[model samples]
Target: MGDHDINEDHAQASDAPPRAGDGPRTAQAKGAVSRWTRRVHKIYIICFHRGFAAFLVLPLVLALVFVAQKNHFGADQCKARESGCGFVGNEDAYGLGIRLGVYLQWLSVFLVVYLLPSEERSLMTSLITFSSALMMAILVLTFGGTCTYTVEIIVLLWTAFMTQALASITHTAQEIDDAGIREVPVISGLKRATTFQLNLDSPQGMHGFQSGSTLVEMCILGYAAWFWVCLLRGAEMVFAATPCGTSLFFFARIQDRKGIVVISALMTAVSLATLLFRLAAWIFRTSVKRWFSKRTYDMLGAVLVSIVYLPITLIAGITYLVPDTWMLKMFPGSGGREQLMVFLCAFVAFIVSVAGIELLLVWNGISDVYGVGSTGQLIPLTMGLVSLMPILWKLLRRYMAGEPLVPEPASNGSGLLIRGTALPHQGSPVEMAARQSDREALQLP
Candidate 1:
């Protein structure tokens, strides 16, 4: 009986499931699987984040390439005819198509902004609207009466708007961090560096302003200023050379050396005046800390800058309205010196304009105060129609079947509505707590 009982015990022990870590091969397999899972997870996270940038960048890149090719062809034609080109003379269906793509891109941006949380949405909308308006004004002044270059102008406007929006977003993120939200150490450092580089505000404490790092930051910003000025000037030359218009006149009369030189000189003077005013304002704010509130200073700064730029705006309008003959008489020369002066003045104006606008936006909080306008509303309304088609079809089918217009909430097997419950709520209390802790640690909303 004892032997039989012992044999039954041994059989039962052999039939039971194997314990964890019982074999070398099993442990090795688990380790390998865990490593692969972590690698895949890392890869997925990178791709998911980078996908957003790719979506925005790829379309713009293609559009630029297409427009550039068209411009090249137009330039060749202009050379063959040995005449200037104007907007009315250079009508191309391809340019119109490029403009359509730009519109679609703006719609995409608007839709994405709509999907964001309320605070983020408001911030993004404000920045986008302000940037859009500012860019539009700049483009109109730069390429007034040159409707043939509309494709280039549209592309540039979108690019500038995105640049401002993204920069503002970064600045806002840093503010959020300072308000208690935390980020990864490396990421936080990078954000701080970027904010410092872009913002005109002096950092707090003597150490911050006096540190060697401050000099490095200034140098970097200077390099950025140089780069942008070169880019804008290059684009200006390219657009001027490209064919357009009815009797083949240069867009913006850019080929008219004297006119271009005068315009550039005026722009440069206005830009410098604005910069000087900004500097004075900055000094006042720093020296007389209690003179006026920060908001008051910002408001006054914006008003003063606008006033400083008003003369240039008026001159540009007059130039646009006046006949070509009168303008030629007013500024009559086609010398190499005039061309050189135009290039030099343009470079300086571009640099100052970039700096002044950035400082104005950051200091005045214009982007924060502005809200989305008619243009913003039109974008989503136009784009959302396509997205609504599937839902509309579903509703129609439901109506035909005599069902309720609004569907009921879906429930899981556990009899709980799934609509509002987060995934963590489905787990045990301990698991939920652990997940909550993890989220808090990561500073997730």
Candidate 2:
């Protein structure tokens, strides 16, 4: 009996299928899955907080501006040994039209990135890019402006469209159930209708949860108004000085003074409207206090990173990491890295505060740090310097006040939203409370 039983058991063991994790192929498959999961996690992290990350492109924008300074195309500042070539003032209105256009471009980008989330975010960003591209395309066709930013805008537009298409695949939402609280899915796809409505929609009206905000958005709104007013006045000067803009609006080939004022006024109206929306957004941000706290620091850090490092990274990647046919045309020089390096050195000097060195060394001395072949081609050198003053001033003020360089984001880690159908085991009171909050966050109506 014993011998037959032992023989039967050995036979059953031999006949059993190999375990899932035992073979080389299984190991390889597991490894591949792990790698893919990690890659996805990385992408989500990088893309999710892109508003703060937008500062990374600041250097690229600067590259577009100062590329003209590397050649003979720039103004008197190009001729000076010190390179902070503020706009050549030879043009009417100290070139305020150009100034207005450039600052608006930066603000437009910041708003799109900062205001929205996921597919909605990308769509808005793409819409803004499309409008700018259309305007720039017309301007280039008629008169002239930098094509590099146009190309960048188009690329971003395409990326946003692609992101919109893939949003469902990348993002996932979980359901939160509060025992009796997870009663019913009231409004189909909307958040759940709970017994007691969540405070997220209404007011919390307490400052304890929020950190130092200074209502920076409101401050920026006021600043934008002042800036646009100056720009409008400057536009008036240019329009009075030259009638080309308004004439072109009506398709008249000859230069006409009336057209410039009309065109400038139209642009002023659009700029004011844009600022109004931004103001509304900032007001909305006050309600989401914890989510939007430390906004100024985020803005400052992003700007500094863009100003300090983006050019070097873009150039290196353009040269070594990606194909370079378009970059060569966009940058018009191989010497950009050197200029960027020099700028870095100057920044370092400013940091050390060596021997009573003036800010002119850092502020007005960064021109001619980019283009190599831009002698008579697309020179945006002058207004480029002016465009950054608003952001830089904001950052420097924050710096002097001893505020944080890199802002710490508020944690919204509490919540009980489970991703799937599995029920949770018994846990402590704190754990149960966290789970309940998670469901409340989902608020599945």
Candidate 3:
């Protein structure tokens, strides 16, 4: 009977389910495996994204360096009064190598753009690539070694500015899409205010240049106009100060004190004006929320911004009309004192502009209209760091800390957890109860 009972007990024990401890052990193993898997996945994603970005940017850098070197040599030749010193003047092996490199780099840009994933390749990216390639071709064919260093620098700066501005606009548009606020009434009104259409079928339209336009197109036109004016004015100032015999190699020697003054003053004025406009809009929006619709307030805000910005533009234009000497006289200083003043003005201007733009985007319902949060902060931060090192560094830090690259979806009070599963208690309830009893007993008198 004892032998039979022992056999039955053994069978029952063998057939029974796993111990309670085994479940936790299995879960721990799973958690560890998942953690490692996530780390590997993160590393792969970082490598992929950054590698692609670097590939896209490399051609532009190489092209700029090669073209600038070639142009510098050509400019040097021209300055020496050498015969046949023009864009096509250089046929030496070195010159040919530079030209070949430039051509290859330009081609590489197109190739890289083509290789981008379809989802990543947008109209703006195409346009930027095309424009950059066209500009490079023009510079190579027309200017060659004959172009002044100042002219070369200006062209490069203009290209970079245009690229950055278009990128910003594209990013903003994407944010708007992601926020799902494209159909917002205030946004629609703003779009309408900025956009214009011309009817070619109408008799009056035949005489006038008319076509459909978008907010992006309008912003482009405005940027182009502003940049051209600033470039021309700044160029005039630089040329006037720079001597004819100034070496092309020492391009920085070109006195741009006047240019600095004008830019600093203009930036300061515009930044202050933007801040004031933001404040006024906020006050108006708050005060009239009960009296007027949001769309109306937004439209009024747009009008107010335009009114404020227009005067600043006009004033800048009028200043450009005045002589540089006259402008300089307005800010009285000489030597180091003048330089210090210029530095202060520029510093102040930059600080104020950053602050103003940040407030305008965050507080003025701009981000709300676009359906973004603190991500909008990236617009200002990343715009200034075109090299993208900071962004990459941020990603690396986040990954190392085991934090997510993208922000978690904000809680909407739905009480539905999106991230981790519920974890079991570290100690069993019975063990906890025993510990509590011990502490209670120890405290008893």
Candidate 4:
């Protein structure tokens, strides 16, 4: 009888079905949620691996190779495969030298920005960083060579300014005349588009960014380059005036007074020409003029370009003739020269910094402005200050509600159950009661 009872109990336990309160629906819901989540995750992974490569990665690699070539020579020589010498060293390497100079100045700017980490950088920022690095690497190649300190300074500042300008344009512009809107050039096409994807007739057509911002970025870059050239000329002139003892041998051996005078004259003419060119460009949107006139605008831009060329031509001319007095005349005076120079440099730096800051602000406001706009420096500073308001409000609300400064999960045992459904405890109530009774009986014995 005892064996039969035990057999009957085992059979009953085996035949019994699960209770309806086991939260089977909740389990099924969780399974559905998990499946969707996995699908989304897989899509993201595929996009990252394939799309990033097809659109962004391959172009970057090509740009890097070009950068490597420029490090050895300049941008000009990178494409010159015919120059008998396969690479090591070549003649009149100064043009490449100037390119190297631009790279270093930008490096300092990059370092300063990192001091305050902003939110995550976007594709535009990454491309700018890459381009800047490449430019800097090229500059380093010319570190101890024949390029003068003045030339290096000018190049560095100009290069950095250019990189920043390009970044702003690439991020904001909807399309270039060539590149389709969908696949824009992130950095290389600052002034104009150079990427393969910039086809004009694609479905993602270009709508063009704000003309104002583009003009500003271009102007800033132009001015930065001009400033470097001026500083270089002025510094060179000053050094010429105070030749050290070591310069005596070379000074005496070479004396071409007429050549120096002619060179100086040519440089002056060029400076005037560049100034004219700048004026014309500012007035007339076109790169080429329809007609020539004696208008002051055309004259000014021509003068500035001419001026940029002047220092080189001027220095070359004076290498033999004018002597130290002429140089001193060209350099800015030395009455507290250190203080004056600092103030001037700072002023220019402030303007460039503002250019960068304004770009981000305007981009955020892009939707309303048709991806084209300019905000005052004051506006950016104000916006940056105002961004803090939301963060502060969140904090204040938390404090007022008497909510724990940090979140604390509920402490009730029953409340520990998840939100959607209730799950019953395992085992039948009758079985639990019988087990308790058996325990009581044992204690009594």
Candidate 5:
């Protein structure tokens, strides 16, 4: 049962006389509860604040490296097949670099949020987390008009989804923290579940949650709309990339008056226009027409697109990676062709990424640097992997250990947000039990 239910029961009980047996039982429970809560609190308090700081620092440093390497060369496969000397026909690589910059800034915001004490991460943290998502979603929408590579589209959508998922998890954590949930609910034993699900849509779930604010409503609506748009756009991209996918897409288009193309153009135009408007609002306060301060609109947009839609995009992206078996069942040989194209496109992208980084290193006057003669070709790849090492290490360690390598900011913060709506202001029962036991046993009030 939820905390509110428990509170109601207590209120009802208070109106009636207590049973003769209750006083002794209540007294007996107090000592044990006090002892447990005290000990558990100490155990959870053993957090490595420094570790969280380090996590934030590494991403920021690498993000800078990624931005500096913005100069791009053409995709190697395109250079080999189309032009003898060089090719600059497609600006995909350039776009990818810019997107990475966007990714870096978003990542920094996420990390900075964790730097503050969990309790302090209120609506502002929610904004920061969701805004990062919105920025990326808009970028994807803006680019959806032109991008058609099968593998690249898959990667872009996949990355978008994963980033948003992480952001949502973080946002849920902040909400829980704000709601004063110090302990995650217990399902099994004395051990606590590190991560539990939280239902962001539930106002009653959070103790002090109030959703009367226009910003919150906008966030909910905006996120839902963006998610719907991205899913449609991703489908369109898939259709455009594959021959089999395209034939069906066009047939559908024939039925729907070329809807995919229209969506692509409309989405790109609106996303671009929204960005420009945000800039104009900031510079000249043009959002005065909306009757709210320009700042409020900014906040509203952040919550809607970044927090809500970002995660939805991620969920949709995962569906795209589903096996082509359904298509194969319809046509025996078509799947193989699509698979080959994907592999080739992936290879092209890998070559392009490495070349872009290497060119940047050379351009910055790093002559014949660390890996030039023997491992020259591998230099860019090496740095890229190195930049990702910190994140990779944690993920790999978690995989091997079957648990998180580092503790979350809250005792129960590391894992999934449990789909909970109402929790007591004190925390879950396990938290209450532990806290009570600790305090009583240790002679603390």
Candidate 6:
């Protein structure tokens, strides 16, 4: 009777219910959710595959067919003309148009990569940046048009937008986590938490190819797309004079008469200044990228550089494109002419100033990254050297080509001075002076 009672009690207790913190039941629920998520992931992958194939392959095939049909040549036509006929050919712009389309295509790809659920985004960003860089290089080398540059600018802007969106999402998710919150609290908080944790573990939260991505996350990811767009447009204004005939169709802004006059002048100046500064940065290897965390400095520097680039480009562009007669009319003949010269001088001065800013930015980057003092010490030399190299190199090369070398003001490190002698070629006076200056710079305490 006692044994029977004991057995019945044990069965009843087991049948009553499972207690809280039952590991097996929780594990089973997790397993089921994992299966469902996996299925969803598979479907997403398939969708992406289809989209890529349709968008990329189909368009490529159609483009090839269209080009062939439009540009076909007749075999008998050449024989008819003893002298080769200057047959009507396709516009170079058409080719540029195709290239522009390709760039936009890549931009679209980046958008998808950036917008996809987080787990797959890292791989996508790596593929996107690398691929786009190659395409950009190709466009730069071959097409070399304002249209090409415009596309490049657009792509960069798109990248900024994508980055900001990712950052915003990441920040929001983090905030949610800190609040011990679920995105959909009503739909099983534990499951949502588990899924979120899974996303964090995946590439969705971390990118592999990006440098100082943590800093990037802190810097760029939390920002909005509009801010990035403004910066990109500002940067684009630096080289605003170049004809982007078709690109205007895509990205141009209409202006009132007074506004047009003002904007044109501003853009031209900014563009010229930015271009000169970029040249200086390249020559000196005084990249802001070297001094600071690539992500942080790039984001911050981007803002300042863009602001400077915009107004300058507008001025230069206006000066170049506007009728000289009209420009001369705007200010009285003597005063306007003087103002024109002043504008040119100011643009040049701006370039020199920004070159200094760029060098300082570089030094800051180096200090931040490597704890190196070399950058700080070399800052002034880098600034002066970079600004001078382009003007000197261009002039020297021109002189070598037997072109008349018009003298421009070269800095004596004390003040701007007229050259007493021509700039050197193969150990010329200027070369010797530069070497001596460099030596003195290197010896600085």
Q: Per-residue lDDT for 1-445 in model 6, tens only? A: 1234323422432322344666896765565444433333332222221221222233333432344223323334323321221121112221223223323333333222212112223333433333344333332422232222232333333333232333322222222222221112212323422443323333322211121222232222112122223233444331221221212111233323344444434444543343333333332222344677746743654454446446544564465565658765553332343246334544454344334322322322211221223333233234323433444564466467554343222322111122123323455676445434322321212
Error of 1 at 153 (Å): 7.1
Better of 2 and 5 by TM-score: 5
TM-score of 2: 0.20
Instruction: For candidate 3, report its TM-score.
Output: 0.22
Residue 217 in model 2: lDDT: 19
TM-scores, all models, native as reference: 0.26, 0.20, 0.22, 0.21, 0.25, 0.21
lDDT of each: 0.33, 0.29, 0.33, 0.31, 0.33, 0.32
Q: What ranges in model 6 sit over 4 Å off?
A: 1-119, 122-445
Tens-place lDDT digits, model 2, residues 1-445? 1234323422432323346757987765565444433333322222222222122333433443354223222233224422123312221111233323333333333322212111222333333333334333322321232211111222222222222222211111111111111222112112221233422222121110010011221222222233234334543221111111211222233234455446445544543443343333333322333455456634543443344344444553443443345434432233333223333343343233221112221222223323323332122323333333544453454356554322222111111111222214235665345334433332333
User: Tens digit of lDDT per residue, candidate 5, span 1-445?
Assistant: 2345323422432323345667876855564344333323222221111112222233433432343123222354323423222222222322334334334433433332332122222423343343445445434533344323332332333333333333333434334333422322212211211222234444334312211121222232233334335445545322122222221121122113256446545544543333333333233222233676646754554443443235434543453465668535432342232333333344444344434443432222222233223332243234333334444453464346454322222222322111112212254565445333322221211
User: For model 4, what is the error of residue 294's alpha carbon versus the real structure, in angstroms, after optimal superposition?
Assistant: 18
lDDT of 6 at 328: 54
- 2-65 per-residue lDDT for model 4 (tens digits): 2343234224323233446649876655654444333333222222212212222233334433
Superposed on all Cα atoms, model 4 deviates from the true structure by an RMSD in Å of 31.4
- In terms of lDDT, model 2 sits at 0.29
lDDT (Cα) of model 4: 0.31
Q: Which ten residues in a row have the lowest lDDT in candidate 2?
A: 205-214
Where is model 4 more than 4 Å wrong at Cα?
1-152, 161-174, 177-217, 220-278, 281-445
For model 1, give the 10-residue run with minimal summed lDDT: 412-421
